[model samples]
Target: MTSPPLSDLTVVKRAGRIAAVQASVALALVLLVVGGVVFAVYLRAQNRQIGAELRTLAMTADDANDPPPDMELALRENNGHISTSDGGEPGVPLLTGATGFSDIHANGREYRTLVVDRPEGRVVAMTDLAPYHAGRNRLLMALGFAELAGILASIAVVVLLSRRSVRPLANALALQRRFVADASHELRAPLTVLHTRAQMLAHRVGTADVRTLQKDADALVADTRALGDIVDDLLASATMAARKQARDRVDLSAVAMSVRDSMASYAHSIGVTVNLECESADGTAGFDVIGSAAALRRALTALVDNALGHVHHGGTVELRVRRDGAKVTATVADDGVGIDPDAMATLFTRFSHGAEHTTREGREPYGIGLALVREIADAHGGDIAVASKPGEGATFTLTLPAAPPA
Candidate 1:
C-alpha cells in the first residue's frame, strides 16, 4: 500500500482526536439517557406491582379472620391486646393508625401496610418490601457495571478503528519523503556541473583583456553562486524535512566561522563587513550541540546572506555564538534597515517577502532561506527567534540544546 504524505499526518491525527472525543461523549450521553429511561420504567412497574400486592392483602384481611399467605396480619381488640399472624406483637403498632395505605418499619424489616376499621376493632395487613428492594438494588448494580464495560469497549474500538483509518495516510507520507530524497539527489549532479563551469568561466575572465566584460562576469559568478546556494538549500530542506539525518556533536562556533569565511568574498563584493564572535576563549566546550554540521552551516550561511541583502555598503553584520547552561545560541545581527513590524510575522514563511518582490540588491528574495533555516533548526530539536524594529536592524537567533558533558 502507498503511504500518505507526511504533511497529512498532522491533519489525520487532529481529525482523529476530534472524532474520538465527539464519539465518546455522544456514546456516554446515549447510554445515560437510555439507562435512565429503562430504570424509570422498571421502577414504575415495580411500584405498581407492590401496590397491587398491598391491595390484595387489604382485601383478604377485610373479609376473613386470617391474613393471606404472603402477608403479616394484626387484629386489635377494644381494650389493648393485639393478635398477630407471626405469633408476635411486632405488627401491633401498624393497627393503631387510621385507615388507608402507608409504609411501616416493623422488626427491622420494611413493609407496605394497610389499616381498616372492623366491627370489633382494627385490622392491619403488611407485605414485606425487603426482597423487592434487594432485587432492584442488584439490578441497578448490574446495569452500572454494564455501562462501565460498554464505555471501555467503545474506547478500545475507537482506538483500533482510528489507527486503521490513518494507516493509509501514514504510508503515503513515507512515499512522499522517499520521492523528495530521490529528486534532490537526481538534481544535485547537474547543478554541481553547472556551478563548476560558471566558476571556470569567471576565473578565465580574470586574465582576459575584456575590461568592459568584467562587470558581466562578476554578475554571472554571483548568479551562479546564488543558484548553487538554492540547490544546496533544496537538498538540505528535503533531507532535513524527514528528520532522519544522522546527528553528532556540532560546534556552533565552528559553523559560524565557516559561514563567515565562505561569505567573505560575497560580503566584499556587496561592500558589507561581516564579523564572527564566540563566547569562550578557545570555543571548545559549551558551543557543542547534537545536530547535522552541514545543515547547521547552511542555516548560518542563509542568515548571513539574508542580512547582507538588507545592509548597505560598509554596513556591519555580526555572527555571534554563546552558551548558557544547557542551551547554546547563534545570532546573526545586521546594521541594515531593520525588518518592518508587519513583515515579522511571516518573515520565516516560504515566499513571504514583506515589502517588495526583490531586496535592496535588486535580487529577488527566494524566501526559501529563512524557511529552510527554520526547518533545519526544528529538525535538530532547536528553534529560531527574531527581534527587529524599523531602522534598528534585525537579529535572528538560532537556539539549540547543548550536547551533554563528555
Candidate 2:
C-alpha cells in the first residue's frame, strides 16, 4: 500500500481562490477611492454654487415683495418690523443678528441663509436645499450601484485569469506525481531483486567455485539491465498522455510469469512460494489484452507484492490468469491473515491501509499501490475486485477486456 498525500490540484485550486479574493479586495478598494473622490468634488461644487446664488440674491434684490424662484427674501425695517416675500414662510428662520451665511433647518426643511446689514435695515436671503440634497442622494445611489457592479466584475475576471494561470502549474504538479508514483511502483520489485542478488553474490564471493561466482555476477548484471529498462519505460510513459500512448497486444500469462520471476528472489528470502497458472476457455496459449505493457506489468507487480506482504513465511501466493468470453482476468491469491471486514470498503482508496496487516519487512504498506492498480485497470478499460474473510486469505481479481483476435 502506498501512502496518500494531499492532491496537488487541490492545493493549486486553494491558492487560486486565495488569489481571487485578494484581487477582489484590491479592486474594491480602488472603486471606493474613485467614488469617494467624485463625491467630494460634487459636494464642493454644490456648496460653491449655493453660496454664489445667495450672495447675488441678497445684494441685488430690491425688496421682499418679489424674489427669485426657490428663494425667500426677508426685510427688517428701521422700525424693528420684519417683512418676507413668502408672507413669513415658516420654513425660513430670521437671523438679523448674524451677518454671515448659515445653514438653517426648520419646519422639516433645509435652507442656506445669507444675512447682510444695509442702511435701511438688514437683508436675509434664504434658498431651499431640497433639490441640491436630492441630487446628491441620487449621485450617492449611482456610485453605490457602480461600486457593487465593478467589484463583481473584478471578481469574475480575477477568477478566470487565476484558473488560466494555474492550469500549467497544475499540470506540472500532476506529471511530477505521476512520475514518482510510476517509478516507485515499477522499481520496488526490481530493487528487491537487486538487493537479494547482491547478498547472494557477497555470500558466494568467499567460495572456491569460480563458475558460481560468474553465474551470480551475470545475474546481478542482468537484473541491473532490467532495472535500467524499467527506468527508461517510466520516463517514456511519464512524457506522454496515457490515452495517447501506444497500446499493443500484451500477453497476460507472460506478464504474470515476469512478476513471478521478478519476485522470486524476494519470495525465497522470505520463505514464501510464488506460483503462476494460466487458463483459457478456447485453449489459447496466451491471454492477451490491448494496453501499455509497462502499465499492465506494474499493475500485476503491485498485486504480487501486496500478496507477498500479507502471506506467512511458508504461505503460498498464486498468480492466476484466465480468459472468459471477451474478458481476461488476472487473480492474485494468497493464504495468509486476511483483511479485516471493516477495512474492506476502502481497500482500493489511496492512503487507506489495514491496521492489522504489515509486509514481511515489518513495515506498514504505503496504501497507494492498490490504488494505482485500480487506476491502471480503469485506464485500460478494466476493473479490479477483492474478496476476503477474517483469518482467511484475500484474492484480488483484475479484469480487462481482451484484445480482438488478429
Best by TM-score: 2
Candidate 2, pairs of clashing residues: 1-366, 1-367, 2-366, 2-367, 2-368, 3-366
How many residue pairs of model 1 clash at the backbone?
Answer: 9
For residues 1-406, what per-residue lDDT tens digits would candidate 2 score against the true structure? 9878767799898999999999999999999999999999999999999999999988887778878877888888688877788734642356446688888776788888888877887789889999999999999999999999999999999999999999999998987887687557757877898899899889878774999889889778877876774554454444434456458999888988998999999788888999999999889645989998888888888888888888888989989999998999999999988899999899987656776554444243556668778878878999999999877889999999999987
lDDT tens readout by residue for model 1, 1-406: 9997655668777787778777777887788788888888989999888778766665556433556555777877677667777632556766766787888776787777778776777777777888889888988998898888887888778867877787777777776766566555545655675566666666777575676457556666666666666667666666666667658988889889989999998788778889988895345566889988988998998899889888867889999999877789999999878898888889998656655321345344556789888998888889999998877788999999989987
- CA lDDT, every model vs. true structure: 0.77, 0.83
What are the runs in model 2 whose C-alpha is more than 4 Å off?
1-5, 77-82, 87-95, 225-406
Candidate 1: where is the Cα deviation over 4 Å? 1-218, 280-285, 356-360
Question: Cα RMSD (Å) per model?
Answer: 12.8, 10.8
Query: Over the full model, what C-alpha lDDT does candidate 2 score relative to the true structure?
Result: 0.83
Clashing pairs for model 1 are 3-171, 3-172, 3-173, 4-171, 4-172, 4-173, 5-172, 5-173, 6-173
